[model samples]
Target: MPIHGIGIDILHVPRLAALIERRGLSKLASRILSPVELDAFCSLTSQSENKRALAANERGPTEPIVRFLGVRWTVKEAAYKALYPLRPTWKELTYTSFDAKKGLKPELVYASLSPDTTPAKLHVSASHDGEHIVATVLVEQG
Candidate 1:
């Protein structure tokens, strides 16, 4: 299937961090996230198993985790933008995972639900340029 929509977004990490701090994860999660999305976010932010695995590598825990979260956040925003033309409701979309098969190459996994449709495939990609994160979302109807 051809892509239904393309979306790109750029975000500043510090700004997003401040928003999350002020509003709390639950609020943000409820507003913009699904159960799978919340799980993915928390896994990057608070999972000890993933943290330990990442820490065992050379880049250490903190920086990698921060970058991972930033990329995930950007992907979420990109996914939202992609779905705007179709679903339009944030509650209908959810991200499942963000995986870096190679450095700076991320694979975003997500699911979208809408009336009259079962679920569609949502793909997201993220990259970092200096202090900003950039993401691209592609939605395909099946």
Candidate 2:
């Protein structure tokens, strides 16, 4: 397969948490997440709410929320960087949605690609620790 480009990003959870605290969740979520992503994020929050009381020890009181936002932000930035030359402004590129692969791996779904290009085929990987979240994107050449 031909190589198009690769992009990677690392984000500090504290930085994003601060933004969420300052700007509020609705505003930040609307600006950053695609409709589908927003839905998924909401679902995650709802799930966390229900589970929080049950498993208070296994999950941190706030890390799940912080990590979720941080991972989404990192993945979007990585996708944007991978498509660098064809870069639309961040707001223009709402095409990169995500889903879970069979083994619970995350998959990138690029919906609004240029006509000349084949459907964007992206390989994505992401991870988060208590302090940081990092992601990588591999954009396939068509």
Candidate 3:
């Protein structure tokens, strides 16, 4: 396999938290995540509703919610970078889906692909510490 490109992104958790604080999760979700990703994020965060209520005050936010949004943000940014040259603008590119096939493993689906090129293979990896979220993407071409 030939390496097409690689991209990596690191995001501060608080930045996303602030955005969510200002824009609200629903609005932010519409901007950044696809319907599938939004659904997954909702489900994941909902699992912690009790904890969310305890952690949340009049302002709405919980750790899981922040991290989930952050991870999605970072991963999408990295994927955009990896698709360099073909660098479609963020508005032109959309993460069509994210499926957690097993455990925490996620597969990315993209919409509005450029006509000239397509990735033969794609790999994504993501991690989050309490403070930051990081994601790396590797693209392969035949």
Top candidate, metric TM-score:
2
lDDT of each: 0.62, 0.72, 0.70
How do all models score by TM-score?
0.61, 0.77, 0.76
Off by more than 4 A, model 2: 50-61, 88-104, 113-118
Give a tens-digit lDDT track for model 1, residues 18-45.
Answer: 6666776446656665566667656655
lDDT of 3 by residue, 1-142 (tens): 8888899999988888888888877778767766666677677666776555644346676777777778778887998888676664444433333456744456654554567666446688888877988988887763
lDDT ranking from best candidate downward: 2, 3, 1
Candidate 3 has a TM-score of: 0.76
Q: Candidate 3: which stretches are off by over 4 Å? A: 45-47, 50-57, 88-104, 113-119
Report the C-alpha lDDT of model 2 over 32-116, residue by residue, as the tens digit.
8777777777787678779666453344336776676778789879988896676643443343334455345567766664565
